[model samples]
Target: MVWAGMCAAIDHLRTHKNGKLIIFEKGGGFGGTWRDNVFPGCCCDVYSNLYSFSFEQNPDWTHIYPNQEELLAYLTAVAQKYDLYKYVRFNTAVDEARWNENKKQWDVTVVVNGGKDSEYGSGYTVTSDFLISCVGQLNIPKYPHIAGSDSFEGKIMHSARWDWSYPLDGKNIAVVGTGATAAQIVPEVAKVADHLTVLQRAPAWVIPRHDSIISEWRKSLLRHVQPARQWFRAESMKARESFHEAVTQAESAKAKQMREITLAHMHKQLPDRPDLWKIFTPSYSPGCKRSVLSDDYYPTFLRDNVTLETRTISRITKKGILFQGQESETEFDLIVLATGFETFDYMHPLKVFGRNGRSLTEIWHGLPRAYKGVTIEDVPNFGMLFGPNTNLTHNSLILVIEAQSRYINALVDAVLDVKAHGKHLSLIPKLEVIESYNLDLQKTLKKTSFADPNCNSWWKNSEGIITNNWSGTAVDYQNLVSDVIWEDYEIEETDGSETFVLRRKASTHIGRVNEETHLSTSTLRSAFVKCRSFLNWFCYSWNSQVDTQYEQVLKLSSDSEYNKPSRRLET
Candidate 1:
């Protein structure tokens, strides 16, 4: 999808005569997370309405939860429709991105096909005005540090890298971790495997997932009357947003209702086994970790062929897994680790060097922090799509990604405007402003369920800091990025010599991008028309309005300045 978007962006720029856009992909394929996690039963947890891009709503989604292959296909289709394949350079990993203060461009180093032994090749670097890091959180798989792991004679594989060639049929499988991946894989494997012993260090609270194929007639209705679908999407998002609020807020009616529903569901599922229920039910409030939804997970436990071992495994012996209390070893033909990704180590595969020759790793040694989860204070001309604190426990990620795209595009426009006006440029967020924003975030997080000490989730770091998730609802984040507060940023002018723009108060016109004036009225109108083509490709109410307004603004070229206001559009 990133590749496709990049291609579309580049094509749009080319057609409209905007600016250049280059995309670099580390892997041989485009789909970010979809390309990586090929585990069995891996699918989206969020409803399809909330999960998909708001601009490109998929009316033909087979189920509420789409599997990896379907998602990959959808992304591919999106790319194909947008004609974005040309801009993407696959099998090339970015090694470093160094910001040149003098040149006002990023020197990005990339390692292409840098594989092991004879397969390895030389690396190269490229320079660009903007840098976008779309490397998702779940790209790198996390391996458990079990003793004598290598000593195991049986076939062992991480869930992310599921060896499809190896057969699991009639085999004794010891599946570790009862997280999202495990929940899906267990039921599927139980149908085939002779005996499946699932090692559960911690049990997740599973909710009913009534996933079914939507009727063709219903899909047709959705396609025809998109407003109805849009309404459904809005309501679903609103419900999720409300859920987020309930989780964050101390004691609310919604929160109480949620608790009751969860408990009721739990009781309904595991009526006979309260001991299992006790372990499964979280002590801390819901939304501590990413809330999982699954109807089949609990019923899968009832199967006589499967066993959920609550006892923690001490080590991996030569014969089999050794539990803390068990004398008899549970031997296995195959061991599958369903442990999740290494999220903290973002872009670990590629080396990125920013200002002062400092690596991103060095900058964020203990805790990763970003101003608005997109830009770092020192990292200039670089934007992160799924950056720190942007991960949602309750809402759709596509909304976050789209917001990021808009924000970054605005920054790009600012950069281009500066260049066109014969001015050198650099944009950096104010330290005090960033500190204040983070301080508020910390305060808000302190009042949330994630801050509960009883809950130890991957959302927090080793120091127990909530660095992954946003402190509030998605709307709060959207509001934060709604406008670029110029007072919160430092702009540098370097046409001849670098000079800092004088610090101003919270004024409306602070560091506003200069309006374009070279193009004729007809040419401007034509450009707007070309830009509107994207709207036709991905029709949404927001895009439709934006296109119409943009065309109108172009037609009234004399009043172009009115549209180039200091404040960003609320929509």
Candidate 2:
């Protein structure tokens, strides 16, 4: 677990009887994207009420869409509230995780930077029964393919890695790429910059959002009344689901109306600058590219000091940026490449070795496909969050992540049962299962806006396969991951000796255990509400063996080693 996605995975695992969670964050602190992306006016597109862990919802958001600082503070508070910092090893980056067939464990390598001492300066290895890749799709930032990015004499920076020390109060700035990050940065920079030039390769549809502050009374209602908070959250989720047409059906009447709504705003804002309107209007479908929501992004273009460049970029010179086939160049004191992340790379910057010494990157060959976008065929005992085709265009990604973590924990519990049986086990999804699933997935995604060929986005891979997002609504993904179909996996059992128990379900001598250690079925079921039926949700009759076994599992989690919180950094 490296970033926000992994932080969530860590949170889920800690609650279960799963093994110890050692979080290796490459940064000095947690919060992932919220911690790293500190560009001017950078904020979440989704409403704050819904953009959080379902287990722990915050009712104190000042704005509907919280700013970077507020989002980060919220995440930090979440980590503190959960006591997650103690288990975290900050400044430690995980390099590779290889599955050991003999030990049936994952051998992980990590390089530690800025640790307490030189003991871990050269890095070390750790082994665990399960491996989860929570390194999200947006971890690595993508830079523009300019000829002289490194050679540029001026201050150059990426939106993800904003350089705050460099002053931009009265300097001429060039912001590249008209994406989400650029959309927010351009407005704030133009406020004080002498001249701000926005470089646009493609235009995205801009929707109006009433991103106003939440009043004290409303915040109090959300905080004091539980039903009110739930109602608000439910309505916000429903609003996201209402975008089904704009995201999936471009030719539909609703999609057209949605398009007109954005154009109406543009018509009202850019009446005097019709040339700019033509340049800003997108020829592609409304949902082909990610739609931007802002109250001021369009109006900021009307400022006298702000300029929008719609031409192709040729290269970057020592002084400024040069345009294609144009002799003239725009001089700037600083440049911010608001270009997004390398999403098509999928699980890039991390090496994962699965069955038969096959690397995950080599298996996909730069293309990612998964069973339900959570499980893979070759990667035994390994799971990932926000994996291929799991990103959502309509609902908050937090919902998808919640579903995924629940499903993953279900698998982890299954593995834990096998470990308790004094057996080495490995569960990998069947190839036929994933192939069939992906075949239907590709067919379904073809009709969605993510697969639109008119505009380019990181949503699709080089093969034109929509690998970055889920085609269905958030609720659909929730139902799909609600159950863990055991038959879909190929389970291997080795007793650590020459003997092998192949394709065997976890045997606990069901219905037989000492009566003295028995716990009631109702009591066991109530113990773990989140993992309700953790021991056995499949079997109809409650077994005494499972009851005792479940008690042992609970005991493991409640034990001093697991229950005792490590030394955490106080907020």
Clashing pairs counted in every model: 1, 0
Taking the tens digit of each residue's C-alpha lDDT, what string does model 2 give over 1-571?
2334554555565665345677777888877888888989989999788787766778899987889898888888877876778777878888898989889899999887774833646789999888877888886889767897776788999999998999999999999988778888988999999999898889999877667676665676568767546645754655576575666778876577677778887888777878878888998887787888876889888899998888788888888988888897778899998989988766677788999889988888777888999888789998888899998876688887777777777677667767877877788999999999999999998987777788888888766788887887776677678667777888777754323234444331111101011233355445424343422332222233234322222222222221223311111
- RMSD (Å) of each candidate, 1 decimal: 10.5, 13.3
Please write out the lDDT profile of model 1 over residues 1-571, one tens digit for every residue: 3532443364336444534666777667667777677777788888776777666788888775788898888888877766566666677777778888778888888777635511655677788877777776776889989988999889999988889999988999989888778888888999899999998776665655656665565566568766546655654554455456546553655455556656677788878888877878777766676666777777777888898888888889778888898887778889999888888876677677776777878877767778898777777766777778888877777767666666766666666666776776777777687788778887878778788777677888867788888886566566567566665677766764433233333433212111113333344344435544532233343244334322221222323222244323233
Q: Report the Cα lDDT for residue 53, model 1.
A: 68
Worst-scoring 10-residue span by lDDT in model 1? 507-516
Cα TM-score per model: 0.84, 0.85
- Relative to the true structure, how large is the alpha-carbon lDDT of every model? 0.69, 0.74
Please identify model 1 stretches exceeding 4 Å from their true place. Answer: 1-18, 114-121, 496-571
> Which pairs in model 1 have colliding backbones?
209-295
Poorest stretch of ten by lDDT in candidate 2: 508-517
